[model samples]
Target: MQQRFYDQVPAVVLGYDNALEAYRSDKFASFPVQPDPGGVIMAQNGVWGYYGATPTAAAAQSTGSNTGLVVAVVGGVLIVLLGGAWLISRRRGARAEDRE
Candidate 1:
């Protein structure tokens, strides 16, 4: 059914704010209407969820925290240095054996 196809559409993807802004820009014209259903996200007392045909910003899932990104970079650098030292040691040992 047509309704099922619409169920997959995200409101932002369909240009919700853009449409409203465009319609409001023309003061002399009546706002263009969207008869099709859409979803929206909202929060009630900090309990957030999506409703209707629009998804709320707080509703669409958020992955890992960004606060620890600096730590991750530092850890990665230490790992690379350790790996480089191991590689140099292996090469030096091979060269010493060749001289014998």
Candidate 2:
């Protein structure tokens, strides 16, 4: 295990599996010795914030998959609204032409 210093805290990257599943097993039980893509950190009798924790990437731990997903959802809604507007305008024009 390689020692890594972060925020002046000495830490180690563990080789455990993903935390999502382990955590899913029992969130309370998985409180310590978490899992992440970076790996797992089995604390060796040391106490610190998130010590003996799992390695999770910022993206992986996010509520959403990515910022792009936010944009995609917004864009899709806008596209649907715009398409409906265009269809309505076309229908109105057709009616106007028929009246003329």
**Predicted model with the maximum TM-score:** 2
What digit string (tens of lDDT, one per residue) describes model 1 on residues 1-100? Answer: 4566569754424322523222222222222123323322232233233122343344455756886898999999999999999999999999999999
Give per-residue CA lDDT, model 2, range 1-100, as digits (tens).
Answer: 1444434554544455543333433223233532233434443245542453444454245475588989999999999999999999999999999999
Q: Clashing pairs in model 2?
A: 14-40
True-structure RMSD, every candidate: 16.4, 15.7
- The TM-score, computed over Cα atoms with residue i paired to residue i, of candidate 1 is 0.34
Cand. 1 Cα-lDDT: 0.52
TM-score of 2: 0.37
The runs of at least 3 residues in candidate 2 whose Cα sits more than 4 Å from the true structure, single-residue gaps closed, are 1-65
Question: Alpha-carbon error at 18 in model 1, in Å?
Answer: 38
TM-score for each of the candidates:
0.34, 0.37
Q: Against the true structure, whose lDDT is highest?
A: 2
lDDT of each: 0.52, 0.57
